[model samples]
Target chain A: GIQVEQSPPDLILQEGANSTLRCNFSDSVNNLQWFHQNPWGQLINLFYIPSGTKQNGRLSATTVATERYSLLYISSSQTTDSGVYFCAGTLQGAQKLVFGQGTRLTINP
Target chain B: EAGVVQSPRYKIIEKKQPVAFWCNPISGHNTLYWYLQNLGQGPELLIRYENEEAVDDSQLPKDRFSAERLKGVDSTLKIQPAELGDSAVYLCASSPGGGADTQYFGPGTRLTVL
Candidate 1:
C-alpha cells in the first residue's frame, strides 16, 4: 500500500491571506485528487490533477506525478475557505485510494 | 447532474445494535466506493465496487462490517453488533471507471455509537 502524508497538519489564517498545502506520496500514483471537507461534513471535489496544474477561482493545485507530490494554493482566502483539505491517491491497477491525514485550515474574519 | 446521495445523514445507536447506511451514486458511474472518516482525519477506503462486484474490500472489518452494491447503482454498508469504535462519518463516492477519473462525493452519514 502507498503512503500519503500532508504537511502543516493545522493552519490558521486571517481573511484575505494566502497559503499553500502540500501532499507527498510514497510512490507513483495513477489518480490524485484534492478534496475540501466543509464544516457540515460534505466532501467537495476541488481538483483531479494526476499531473500538471489546475485552478478554480481562489483555489489552485499542481501535481508532479514523477515526484509523487501535490501542492494546493489558496489566494485571498475567505471565511468560507475554512475546512479540512485532503489529498487522496491510488496507484495503477489499484481499486482503492490512500489518503493523507489532512490539512485543517481555519480562515478568520 | 446530481452528485452522490447518502442517507439518513446521521445515526445514533447503542453498542451491539445493527445499523446500516445507504448510498446512491451519480448517474452513469460504474465505480462506487465506501470510506470511513474519523474526526479530524481523512477518509479511509472500506470497499470499492466495480458495477455489482466488489474488487477491493481488504480494509473492511469483515468481523462486523458488510457491504453490497446491488444492481451496481445503490450500495449499503452494514455493521452488526456495532462497537463504540465504529462511530465515524461514512462517505460514498462515484467515478466513471477509468485510471484517473474524477470522483464525486456525497454528504457523508455521521454515525454515533453509545
Candidate 2:
C-alpha cells in the first residue's frame, strides 16, 4: 500500500491571498488528481495532473513523479475557495486511488 | 451528462442493523468503486468493479460487507449487522473504463450508527 501525506493539515487565509499545498507519496504513481470537498460535501475535481502543470482559473497543480510529490497553488483566493483539498493517486492499476489526509482551507472575507 | 448519482444522502440506524447504498455511474463508465471515509481522514478503497465482475475487494470485510454490480451499470453495497465503527461516509466513484483515468465521485452517503 502506498502512503500519501499532505502538508498544512489546516490553513487560514484572508481573501485575495495566495497559498500552496503539497502532497508526497511513497511510491510511483500511475495517475494523480486534485479534488476539493466543498461545504456541500461534493468532491469537485480540480485538476488531473499526473505530471507537469495545469491551470484553471486561480488554481494550478504540478506533479513531479520522479520526486513523488505534487504541489497545488491557489492565487487570489476567495471565500468560495474554503474547503478540504485532497490529492489522490493510483498505482499501476486503478484498483486503488490512495488519498492524502487532506488540507483544510479556510478563507475569510 | 449527469455525474454519479447516489440515493439516500444520509442514513441513521442502530448498530447491528443492515444498510445498503446504491450508485449509478456515468452512462459509459465501465469501472466502479466503493470507498469508506472516516471523519477527519482520507478515503479507503473498499472494493472495485470492472463491469459486472468484482475485480478487487481485498479491503472489504467479507463477513458483513457485500457489493454487487449487476449488468455492469448500477451497483449496491450492503453492510449487515454493521458496527459502530462502520459509521462513516460511503463514496462511490467511476471512471470510463479502468486504469489511470480521472474518477468522478458521487455525493457520498453519510451513515450514522447509534
Candidate 3:
C-alpha cells in the first residue's frame, strides 16, 4: 500500500494570488490524478498526469515519478477556487488509488 | 457523456437503522468503485468491482456493509443496522478499464447517523 502526504494542508490568499501544492507518495505509482473538491463536494477532475508536466488555463501540474512526488500550481486564483485539492495515485502493479489528505485553499476576494 | 451518478445526495437516519445508496457508473466503464470519506480526510476505498465481480473488498465491513452490482453497470451499497460511526460521505467512481486508469467520481452521498 502506498501512503500519500500533502503539504500546506491549509492555505489562504487574496484573489489573483498564486499558490503551489505538493504531494509525496511512499512508493512508486503507475498513475496519478488531481481533483478539486468544490464547496458543493463535487470532486472535479483536474488532470491525469502519470508523469511529466501538464497545464490547463491557470492551473498546471508536474509529476516527478522518479522522485515520487507531484506539484500543482494555481495562478491568478479566484474566489471560486476556494476548496480542497487532492492528489491520488495508484501504486505500482496495484489498481487501488490512494489519495492525500488534501490542500484546502481559501481565496478571499 | 455523463460522469458517475449517485442517488440520494444526503441521508439522515437514526442509529441502528438501515440505509442504502445507489450508484450508476459512466456508460462503457468496466471498473466501478465505492469509497468512504470521513470529514477532513481522504477518501478510502471500501470496495472495487471489475464489472459484476467484486475483486477487492477487504476493507469493507462485511458484517454490516454489503454491496451489489447485479448487471455490472449499477451498484447499491447497504448498511444494515448502521452505527453512528458510519456517518460519512460515500463516493462512487468509475474508470474506462481496470488497473491504473484515471477514475471519475460522483458528487457522493453524505450520510449522517443520529
Candidate 4:
C-alpha cells in the first residue's frame, strides 16, 4: 500500500486570503484526485489531476507525477472553504484509492 | 440530472444492532463505490462495483459487513451486530467506467453506534 502525506495538517485563513496545500505520495500513481469534505460530510470532487494543472473557479490544483507530489491552491478563499481537503491516489490498474490523512482548513470571516 | 443519491442521512443504534444504508448511483454511471470515513479522516474504500458485479471488496469486513448492488443501479450496505467502532460516515460515489472520469459523491450517511 502507498502512503500519502498532506502538509500543514491544519490551516486557518481569513476570508479573501489565499493558501496552498501540498500532498506527497510514497510512490507513483495512475490516478490522483483532490476532494473537499464539507461540515455536513459531503465529499466534493475538486480535481482529477493525475498530472499537470487544472483550475475551477477559486480553486486550482497541480500534480507532478514524476515527483509524486501535488499542490492545491485556493484563491480569495471563502468561509465555505472551511473543511477538510483530502488527496487520494491509486496505482496503475488499481481499483481502490488510498487516501491521505487530510488537511483541515478553517476560513474565518 | 440528479447526482448520486443516498438515503437515511443519519442513523443511531445500540451496539450489536443491525443497520443498513442505501445508495442510488447517477444515471448511466457504470462504476459505483462505497467508502467509510472516520471523524477527521479521509474516506476508505469498502467496496467497488462495476455494474452488478463487485470487482473489489478487499477492504470490506466480511464478518459483519456485506453489500449488494442488484441491477447495478442501486446498492445497499449492511452491518450486523454493529460495534461502536463502526460509527462513521458512509459515502457512496459513482463514475463512468474509465480511467479518467471524475467521481460524483453522495452526501453520505452518518451512523452512530453506541
Query: What DockQ does model 3 achieve?
Result: 0.80
After superposition, the stretches of candidate 4 with alpha carbons farther than 4 Å from their true spots are B98-100
The whole-model C-alpha lDDT of candidate 1 against the native structure comes to 0.91
Using DockQ, give the best candidate's number.
3
True contacts kept of each: 0.78, 0.72, 0.72, 0.75
- lDDT (Cα, tens digit) per residue for candidate 1, span A26-108: 98887799989898988888998889999999999999998989999999999999999999988878757788999999999
Q: Candidate 3: where is the Cα deviation over 4 Å?
A: none
Give all candidates' CA lDDT scores: 0.91, 0.93, 0.94, 0.93
The native-contact fraction of candidate 3 is 0.72
Tell me how far the alpha carbon of residue A57 in candidate 2 is from the true structure, in angstroms, after superposition: 1.1
Q: What is the TM-score of chain A, computed separately for every candidate? A: 0.97, 0.96, 0.98, 0.97
DockQ of each: 0.74, 0.76, 0.80, 0.71
Highest lDDT: which candidate? Answer: 3
Off by over 4 Å in 2: none
**Per-residue alpha-carbon lDDT of candidate 2 for residues A5-108, written as tens digits (9 for 90 to 100):** 99999999999999999999998986899999997788888999989999999999999999999999999999999989999998865447899999999999
Report how far off residue A56 is in candidate 4 (Å).
1.4
Tens-place lDDT per residue, model 2, B1-114, is 999999889999999999999999989999999999899888888999999999889999999999999999999999998999999999999999776478899999999999
lDDT of 4 by residue, B1-114 (tens): 999999899999999999999999999999999999898788899999999998899999999999999998999999998999999999999999944368889999999999
Q: Is candidate 3 or candidate 4 better by DockQ?
A: 3
Per-residue alpha-carbon lDDT of model 4 for A1-100, expressed as tens digits? 8899999899999999999999999989878999998887788999999999999999999999999999999999999999999999998777578899
